[model samples]
Target: MISMSPLLRLALLALVASITGWLGGRCRADVGDFAPCLPVFYRCWPPKGLAGTPICQRFGNQYRFATMYSRQRRSPWFSGYLYTVPTGRRPEPQLAYAEADGNMVPFPPGPLDQKVLDSQAVEPDYINSTYSRGHLNPSLHHRDHEDRTSTFTLTNAVPQKIGSNDGPWEVLEQTVNRTLGEYCLGEAYVVTGVIPYQKDERWLRDHRVAVPEYLWTAYCCPDYNNSLPKELREAFPTYAAIGRNDPNSTEEIVPVNQTAKTQFRGYDVRRMTLDTLETYLKDRFTTAVSVFYERCSGS
Candidate 1:
């Protein structure tokens, strides 16, 4: 190894710091806020009255989705994106992880950084745990391989029970995919989030990540096939639903289906109007929670 003079070493260190700072700025510009991803939101307006750090999910040098992350909970408040008609089968998820670069979360096929493991959930957070790393923005909603993989980041996930993650909630995601794929003529914007318990918030891996009490999802389809099916008439424009993540929880919000399959029982999902969803949200957070502006009036 070659040793430089003390003065030269100090000058090199300053130059490296300046370059790192500039790169961080550039990374934020690309994947820090919703400004670069307004098209993902309905009417270019995201949900209001929620507090969290925004992360633009990028993969392979492209923006895939937007997630509002909570540093305290080490999870996402919600993930908003435009629906795409899927063309291929779902990608295999292995721990379904990502590497974080500043505010950007990228799903590269490589080992995760130790710094990322320090801040968010790692493979061990869910290993042997009762909860799974449930995705807020399910890969079923996107068409591109990269877009689908971009959602694997832990920041966009919540600690959801296995039954809900792979059972009824999975059905809900598939149903939405079929509905949006067929009836939605234009863009279908979706926002999926979680609801915490009133008194006791569950945590995973010794409080490293919080487990949600419920998982809620809402979609805004500004324009759709006018020949809508009668059963889906009330579902046009905007619709919302909530699913139970914990079976032992109360049945006020999402009632448990006692007669469900052995594995999927107690993880029932309830469909409701957007207003009703917001009402529950307001009740929990004690403030207004709007998923879409003016109920997705604009196309």
Candidate 2:
């Protein structure tokens, strides 16, 4: 075999990075003109149809986590943060802000200039709305106090119904933590996002934020223990899930259980293989939605 020249090797590397968005073991941070300034270990799989504004969550002049927000929805299309099961009590929720690429001023407790940061969702937007300020990146997923606190930014939230947010959806989040914490041997890359309606979109009470019809999440764990439980044989390499955000949504994707308690009757979570999840997403989005490259395969 012939050896490649140093210049030739460099050129090939650049080509790979451009196509795959994988650089130095982390997904590229620059998604469309915005640099989310993600932590070194964080990964991003930018979705189609939405403009992403990268948020490097800062508190007390320290970088905690990162999020890719959507201005059109006035909420996060998705947020990426490292996961670690907490060791102590979950931190009290404290809403914060990001200046994007604008000012260096610290995040204050009250209102912020929406113009400065490519627009952000404010606290008042959800004040009287029936939906809860649901977190895309939940606080319970991290161990550090600041890391958990960083998840409270409104830009990282969406208008989620209490039935889904506090019920089955919350259970899914906890189950993920337990699963990853016990089975995953190394780092696990997770991406949580939303799916809008094909037509006749739903909006919040303020009409400024769009409410998602379905909430979807997937995780890629390339490294894991081989000694697996009989039931978890297919859960190792990767898995995906979709939960109903609207009770009236069609039962084709997630079948509603009429017998479920009143609070969680219509909100049901369906777990499936990554490919299965993608099929549903493509049908709804009218395009392929690739959550992870090669389904986070490892040889």
- What is the Cα-based TM-score of model 2? 0.82
What lDDT would each prediction earn against the true structure? 0.82, 0.75
TM-score attained by model 1: 0.84
Looking at model 1, residue 90 earns an lDDT score of 84
| Residue 113 of model 2, lDDT score | 69
Model 2 global lDDT (CA atoms, 0 to 1): 0.75
Compute the lDDT of residue 294 as modeled in candidate 1.
79
TM-score of each: 0.84, 0.82
Q: Return the clash pairs for model 1, or none.
A: none
lDDT of 2 by residue, 1-299 (tens): 88999999999999877756533446544454334343323354443443476666666576555566778777777765667767788887776665554322335755556573346666667888888988988888888887777777777788898999999999999999998899888877777888888788888654678899998888887788899899888987888899999999999999998988899989999999999988998888777877665667633
lDDT of residue 138 for candidate 1: 86
Look at candidate 2 and tell me the lDDT of residue 122. 66
Predicted candidate 1 versus true structure: per-residue lDDT over 1-299, tens digit per residue: 99999999999999978755643332222233676565677656778878988777766767677888888888888999889998797886634444444434433556867766666777667889888889899888889887877777777888899999899999999999999899999879999999988887789888889888899999998789989889999988889999999888889998887889989998999999999999999999898998987788742
